[model samples]
Target chain A: MKKVAIGIDIGGTNSAIGIVDEVGTVLTRGNIPTDRHSDINLYIDDLAAEIERIIASTDVELDIQGIGLGAPNGNYYNGTIEFAPNLRWKGVVELTKLLSERFNYPVIKLTNDANAAALGESIYGCAKGLKNYIMITLGTGLGSGVVINGDLVYGHDGFAGELGHVCVENGGRECGCGRLGCLETYCSATGLVRTAYELLGKSNKPSVLREVVNTEKLTSKLIYKYAIEGDALANECFRFTAEKLGKALADFTTFSSPEAFILFGGLANAGDLLIKPTKEYMEANMLEIFKNKVAIKPSELPGADAAVLGASSLVWKELSK
Target chain B: MKKVAIGIDIGGTNSAIGIVDEVGTVLTRGNIPTDRHSDINLYIDDLAAEIERIIASTDVELDIQGIGLGAPNGNYYNGTIEFAPNLRWKGVVELTKLLSERFNYPVIKLTNDANAAALGESIYGCAKGLKNYIMITLGTGLGSGVVINGDLVYGHDGFAGELGHVCVENGGRECGCGRLGCLETYCSATGLVRTAYELLGKSNKPSVLREVVNTEKLTSKLIYKYAIEGDALANECFRFTAEKLGKALADFTTFSSPEAFILFGGLANAGDLLIKPTKEYMEANMLEIFKNKVAIKPSELPGADAAVLGASSLVWKELSK
Candidate 1:
């Protein structure tokens, strides 16, 4: 029988699972909608039932090695999810303990979704063979996983890599975390819309963005399309975003001298529109020692399966150890 | 026969060597005036001769396990000193190689004095058993060594913990590194004097510090004395230093969430006068998760001997490994 480990990526709207082999090949997988139920136990039971149903019908004779879970507010050290704002659950939820009780496995593990994505990148994606790098996930909110000396920096309480919450503009935008001027507020998909609105107020540029702005239908994808079609205002919006991102990257490099910063998620697809300006400004603002080094590249993992691969990589990593 | 290691702390003005045991007991030690000879070879020869002379008549039948060297630009990776600005040496000088050739036994390692001090603190001083923390040495310049996951964070290159060079105030103070507003320029002994001078221009408060308007005559120790004696201007100068230092510390905590920040060097001796206000500001500025949890305390190492114990700890650590 082929040895396999289950990887679960828990999102706000959906959950993904995969049985993966040692070389990052997903042998089998399935997905389930994240129920709106507020009770923590019911959600875990549903997830457990779904996982069992998926693997039971698979043709491949498999030995379930372990389970790795990636979610918001997941603590790698404590094996619990504590006060995840998006998940209406209050206080500490021992997801790992609940899962292990259902699956009789000795190797259950967990990490924040961002860290899992970084592990996936490190093990199977763009950052292969690179020991020092950061993985930035540009989704609804900006998330980062810091890798230094080939290990996740868990700090004293496993809450170290809160890169999104770090202040970029000193006293600029208000964040959901209640902190003002957080980097996430100026660099996420939401931040892009905020930037487009700010630019719309300042500029008299003739563009399709004006129509989108009037309807309040401004999305990062629409902005990318306009910029690619030679809209000056749209192009300027990306430049503005990159400028903040580049300066933040330059500041981050001072702390951990990584060889590269691998970007993942929706906003990362803007590609050269965002990357070129980020690279230019990163170089411009970096200290002398870090000059001409540190590559800013995109994730190599398939976008659709990145979270699953990342979640799987966590179990793969643990089993290997 | 007892096992021992010779720890060398090489400074610009003087060099100190001590024979230290595993438990941090300094059996015997000696200091020699550092010769600023143009020829680098003569400097090495003199250092080795001094070490040999110190151990010549000792009654303890000892096996010199290894030699650990702590210098200005010491690279732990290559065991070389590379263009330390304070030192006249131009190119990469493999001091460990030179020492090993003379001693016939393996001279284990080298690291910058600050890193060595951090290692020393972790192994024998206040930071013993604490995996995550940062040690700040405030002398002629501010220096830092970061510890994450129970080891020194060397980064991609050996030059990771250059916290002094990290820009705190954009276009604020002129740094010796030719960078604008580096943390060191506002937090070191020199920074304290600069703070006092700046205060002298702004405040007309009656204080003894006004007697030294020239930067040459002003020192951190003198300002510390005045602050202790209730000079409002001097107390304000310390508060200014603490605020900058505190903000920087809060920013750094985002990267590596250490349990505490251990402070060392001349100005740290001011105790509560400096630490209290720094602690207050650092807690005030820190993220909600980190507030009031992190301790900012003075280093427990014995004065100048910290570098020696720290250097020795390197060899001892390697041998234990």
Candidate 2:
């Protein structure tokens, strides 16, 4: 029988589940509406049923030993998800306990999505054989995981690597975290759109972004498209985002002195449009010792498979530990 | 025979040597001028001779097991002092190899003074039972050592935890490291003096500091005395220093999320005049989740015994390892 691990990546909008074999192959995949089930027990039941369906449909001789999950507020130390503002679930939910009871699997490991991505990178992505590095997820919000001395830095609190909330502008932009000038306020996909709005509002420059400026349909994806097509405003937005991200990256390097930084998620797909400026700004602002030392690269794991492999890698790591 | 470890604390001006027992007691101590000899071998010979003299003078049956030294830019991984700007040693000096060869001790361990201080804190100071914490030394320049999961974080290059140069301000003050607005630029004892100078230069405020403003003898100690005597400018300087320090602390917390930041050195001895404002400002600038969680406290290690004990603890740690 082939041993497998169930990988679950929980987001605000949806939850993706995949049955991953030992070699990181996703045998079967499925999704469930995470926001629909407000009741915690019903959610667990539904999730377990979905996993069972995936396993049965795959028709493989699968001996699933453990399950690994990635979510916004997933705490590795505690098997609970604590007050994930993005999720419909409120307060500390005993996620692992409830799921484990239903699945009858004792080895269930869970960490924040960012940390999971870091583990995946170390095991299967760009950070292969690298003991020290950082993984940055630049989606709607900026999330990060820092690894040093070959272990994830979970701080005193389970929430150690909150690089997104690190205040970049002491009092520049107001953040959802009730902090001023957080890195997320300037570097996230959300922040990119916000910067685009600010730049367009400040200047009378001509661009395609200005046409969809007032519409709710305008998104970072649209901005990325405009940027790829040589839209000056969108390109400026990417540049501005890179500049902010680079500056923050320089500051972050002073803390851990990582070998490299891996970029994951939506904005990472902006490619050289974003990477070049970020590298330039990071080099410009970096400490002399760290100059030309740290590399910023896009995620090496396939985009569609990243979250699943990242989540699955958690189980593999836990087993080895 | 008393099993002892020789502790050497190398500073810019002087090097202090101490014979310490496992219980953190300093039995015999001596000092040598560090900048006196630019020749590396001569300096090592003199240092070895001084250690021999101290041991001979003590007249104790001491079985010296190992020697541990803390110096600026001390690299644990390579056992070398690399380009310490403060020390007369210009390039990479093979400090550990030279000392170990001269002393015939195979178990010679060396780390940066800040990491030594952190080790000392965990062993003999307030962080005795704490597994995760940060030790901040507010001396000539701000230095830091981070302990997470009960181990010192030696990053990819053995240069992790260089919090002093973590640019708190992007383009603010010019730092000795040739960087702008480093945490050390605003939080060290020298930073306090710089703050006083800035405050005096910017405004014609009535205060006692104005008398010694232009003199070379202007010191943080004098400023502390004036602040205690209700000098508005000196008090403002303390407040400003605290604000800058606190803001940086808040940022630092985001990276490691340490339990408490234990402060050491001259500026730390200023008591509530510094700590109170620093804690207040740090709390004010913190992320909502981390607001009331992280504590900023004075070091519990005795000032007189701290350096010797701190440097000594490194050896003890290595022995156990």
TM-score of the first chain alone, every candidate? 0.97, 0.96
lDDT for B85 (candidate 2) = 84
Best-performing candidate as measured by TM-score: 2
> What TM-score does structure 1 among the candidates reach?
0.94
* Lowest lDDT 10-residue stretch of candidate 1 chain A: A162-171
Write model 1 residue lDDT over A1-321, tens digit each, in one string: 988878899888888998887767888788877656688778887888888888896889888888888989888998888788777677898988988889887588888899999999988898888889999888888988999978878789887887887766556788887766777888889888889889888988787898877786788888888899999998898899998898778878877778899988888989998888999988877877677878999999888778888987887778556
- Each candidate's fnat: 0.61, 0.74
Error of 1 at A240 (Å): 3.3
The DockQ assigned to candidate 2 is 0.76
lDDT by residue (tens digit), candidate 2, B1-321 = 998889899989989999998888889999999999999999998898999899999878998878888998899898999888889889999999888788886478889999999999887788887878889999998888989889898778887888898777767899987878888989998898899889888989898888777664889999999999999999999999999889888888878889999999999999899999899999998876677888888997788878878998888888877
Q: Across residues A1-321, which tens digit of lDDT does each residue of candidate 2 receive? A: 988888899988889998888777889998998988889888888888899888889778988878999998888889789989989889999988888788776479899999999998887788888888999999889889999878888888788888898877756898998878889989988999899889888989898787887665778999999889999888899998998899889888878889999999999988899888999999998877678999999999889988988998888888877
Query: Which candidate comes out best when scored by DockQ?
Result: 2
